[model samples]
Target chain A: MTLLDFARGPAMQFAIFIFVFGIVFRLVGVWAMRHKRDLSEPRQPSAWKGGIHGLIQHAWPYKPFRDKLMTDYVIGYVIHLGLLFVIFFYKPHILFFQDIFGFGWPALPNGVITAISIITIGALVIALVKRLTDPVRRLISNFDDYFTWFVTTLPFVTGLATAGNVWWHYETGLAIHLLSVWLLLIYFPFGKLMHAFWFGVSRYTTGSRFARRGGMA
Target chain B: MSDATTTDIPVDLESKRLTVTRPDIRFDKQGELGDDERVQKAMQHFAKDFGYIAANYMEACVHCGACAQACPFYEANPDPKLTPIWKLEPFKQAYKREAGPLSFFYKTLNLKSKVTIEQLEEWQELLYDTCTMCGRCTLVCPMSIDIATLVGMARHGMFHAGLVPHELYTVTEKAEREGSPLGATPKVFADRVEWMEDEHEVDMPLDADKADVLVLMSSIEIQKYPESMAATGKILNQMGKSWTFHTEGYEATNFGMLSGNTQWQKDMTMKIISTAEKIGAELVILPECGHAYQALRWQGANMLGRPLPFKVQHISEFLAEAVESGAIRVNKVDKSVAFHDPCQVSRRGGATPAPRKILEALGVELREPESTGNLNFCCGGGGGVITIHRADSLRYKIMGNKLEQLDATGAEMMVTSCSNCRQNFDDSGEKLHWDKQMNSLLELVAENLVEDTKS
Candidate 1:
């Protein structure tokens, strides 16, 4: 089969299957690990509240760390919001989702979608630059970190390239975009990208643990 | 940081010098050197000790560097390896290779390097000597990863590998074999109590038939600062409370927790639990030791596999409760003081308000620094870092941030509830020629006790 046909049909289905199966397997595997029962009397009434609160509090830079991370924090939000807007609000993307889920939301104007895609690409580029340039970040980052960034940034860049017909045929660009997405879906369950799911778990557990100790989680 | 000297107390350089004799305990090394045995042992330990939260922390870190800014060691040294998340690489590697969903793929692809004994030896400094397990990194981590607890688990693996620093290794060995890290045996404990009783002219009530309160002191206080023990005795006596110091279990500090030996931690905790149970004490008061409070108040029940028969209280907590209940009244002193919250007692143990309550009751003008209460900076001497004689310079360097914070408050005296913190501050103050006087909260209260009119 041609690359485009594989990317559009079987590859997409396989990526979806791996994505779903891998995420569930990872989450359940982690959950199945034995938790040593905490026999100590909790200082707080409920650890659940602390866990939920921790999730909310960590959405923004904590007060003490804000000054040092202001630029990164703002840019991170911009990238996330831009990705969400471009992913779900584009006309073609909505139709694709409708085909799968039997429901769809209204698409944004073409101009707005293009604008978000450009901004998101710019933000992702900036993030990559920071990761490569900053000493601490550069030290901790590995090939997986760079590869994840590349995969995440590729879809927006490819989509924009296709819509504007800048470098290649629209069909070829779209094929590459789908392939990049499949790569991301398969890679999502491994490496640092698991932060997408583990962030919530980490926050909740840390919050609950701190609350049990009667501290602000 | 302020240069204005507000206190008359001079820097006691001589007293600040710590004279710790390294114990002659030989580490067990039955296996062949450089073999995969130690690495396999550490990996097994990591698999056994870690749970869902630890797994989440290991997987969730994005290398954002926020935790690096929060860590005092990283702040002082600006070293990348000292970053809290970086210290967990070994454990994370173990998790990925052993328990991750894609472990088979990782093994086949050789995606990550295997953990080695040499790597663990290098991580020893990062996990124990430099990091104080202060939990400051937990506060700033955007993922909310509990890096401090992860480091603690990492220490457990290191302990199994026999990679612990000789300082901590020696002390833990002594505590396991001799029953006290400082070699404060039962006779030495009794002698110290008798000396305090004679000096203070107050009854110590040694091994009372049945006391409402059982007071536990650390070997540090017994060996170095008997005044803190004397002050605790005076406060309990003045409050007209039934209390006793059991010679069998007076040492509150647990080297097991510090040394990352779980069995030793349980054994040390059981000693105090059995003693308190035998005495029928309703409350067990931990002396001015931070880890001691954590060893009992927090992890005691978990180790015992049951809830404690008696409630454990830190001396600061006990004093705060006494003051609030009108059981002890104090004349407020007119000194401007700032409180240095010990990491274990305030941050981990949740006794932040207790010391403030006691200070407020004493009528001292309490000055709060930028980092106080739950967010208080560690004194850089906790987690057995002070025991390592070679770490003295690093401790002084890392403590510079805390010294500046305390100085910025412009208080005449710095008060803390932990003897370890006091020792750290004393060392740093003397080394830097800092002029602020350091005071223990318990001693300050004892000195300012009002004459009872009811008598």
Candidate 2:
């Protein structure tokens, strides 16, 4: 098979299987583990409110750490929301979803999607620069952190290359973008990217635990 | 005076310094030193101790660095190692290798470095001395990682590895063997209570069979600040509450918590629970000791495998409830004061509003700092750091952040509900030559009690 065909077929199937299976396995395994009962009576009656509060409250920077994290917070939100918009609303991306699920949502205008993709690439670059330059971020970051950043940024870079038809044939750029996405899917469950699933669980557990004690998360 | 001038309580700076710097007793190293066997044991403990919430926290952290900004230790020194999440490196490695998704890969490839004795030795300061387990980092983490909970889990691993600081190790050993961290025996506690009773001209019910409340005191209050005990007696008496100090479990502070030994923590908590049960007390009152409140009120039920038969309340919480219900009447004091929220009681234990209520009842002009209530800075002497002699300089250094907050308040008197916090303020206040007078909230309430009942 040609490189493009293989990248579009077998590699895509393998990546999806691993992404779905690996996430489920890890999450279920975490849940299956025996948790010691919190025998202490809660000061507050229900922990669910705290858990729900935590899910929403953590979306923004906590008040005490607000000033220190304002820049990261703004850039991070733009990158995350922009990527979501591009993934779900772009015509080509929705076509892939429609092919699998037999349904698709309304697509954004190609020009708008292109603008968001470019902005996302810029945000990711800025994030990478901050990770490399800021002393605290640099200190805590490991090889996995940089690797995840690189893999996540690749599809965006490749998509922009295809859209603008820069540096290579448009078909080749599209093929490379598809391959980069496969790499991310396979790498997602093994590294810090697992935080996508764990963040909600962590925040809910924490919020509930603290709420039960009559404190906000 | 603008309610900001109060007489400085004459403190013998030199002797007080000596009491903290040179404790009368020393903790001799007890067990075998850290070795390969100990490292393996610690790694095993890390694997065994973690449950669902801990695993979630371990995997959820994205290295956002928000926690580092909230940590007083990191803020004081700006050291990367003192970063809250960074301090969890050892525990994280053990988790990755043993229980994580990539454990099989780690076992087959052996890519990670082994947790060495030297590394564990170095981490002693990071885990025990530098960090206060104050939960400030837990509060600021965007992922809600509960870094402080995992820090305690790391301490549990360290404790199993025999890597606890000598000071904490000795104190835990003493508490395990002698029933008190300070070696205050049953007789000693009884004598102090008798002396305070005589001094205050009040009857301190001792181990009464069926009292409505059981009052528990820290060994520090008995040995160092007996006036707090006297003050508690006065308040309880004025409220017409039936309370007794149980000789069997009067010591509220648990060194087990300080040392991170789960078994010891369970044992100490059981002692208090059993004593309260034996006395048929309806409620148990923890003194102005922060960790004691954490040990008894928060972790007590989990340790005992059941909910406590009697309710546990911090003295501040009890007083707040009393003042709110009009069970106790107090004349407002004409002084400007800043209330220091103890980490264990306010942030960790969820008693933030109670102390503020008590302060309002006192009628003092309350001055709040940039960080107050749940986000208050630690007094730097918590989590057994105060007991570790070698950690003195680091503690004093970290106190810079708290001192700056208090200074900004411009309050004449600084009042806190925790004895450990009070000791920290006293020691650091003397060293920094701070002018604000340090007072206990319970004592202040006692002094300002209204004798005539309007009802």
Q: Against the true structure, whose lDDT is highest?
A: 2
- Residues B1-455 of candidate 2: C-alpha lDDT, one tens digit per residue: 11011111111223332122233343322355447778987887888766787888888888877788888888878888888898888888787778876678776788556777877878888898888889898777879888877888898888887777765776676777678766577898899889989998767888788788999998777777888888998888888888899888888988887777899988888888998998888899999999898899889999998899999999999999999999898998998998889998988889999988988998899999888988888888888888776777778877777888888988888899988888787778888777775789999998898865432
- Model 1 local distance difference test score: 0.81
The stretch of ten residues in a row with the least summed lDDT in candidate 2 chain B is B1-10
Per-residue alpha-carbon lDDT of model 2 for A41-133, expressed as tens digits? Answer: 789888888999999988887777888888888998998899799889999899999999999889999999999988888898999998888
Model 1 docking category: medium
Tell me the TM-score of chain B in each candidate.
Answer: 0.92, 0.93
Q: TM-scores of all models? A: 0.94, 0.95
Which residues of candidate 2, in runs, are more than 4 Å off?
B1-30, B452-455
Which of the numbered candidates is closest to the native, going by highest DockQ? 2
| Per-residue lDDT of B352 in model 2 | 94
Compared with the true structure, what per-residue lDDT tens digits does model 1 show for residues B1-455?
01121111121223553323432332323223354777877887888776776777777888788889888888778888888888888988888787766678778888877988778878888887788888888888889888878888888888777677766766676777677877678888889889988998867889887899999998877777888878988878888888899987888989888878889998999999999999899999999989898899989999999999888888898899999999888988998999999889887778888998898888888999987888887888888887666567778887788889999998888899888888888778888888876788899888888758463
DockQ measured for candidate 1 = 0.71
RMSD of each predicted structure: 5.8, 6.0
DockQ of each: 0.71, 0.72
In model 1, which runs have C-alpha deviations exceeding 4 angstroms?
A1-4, B1-19, B22-35, B453-455
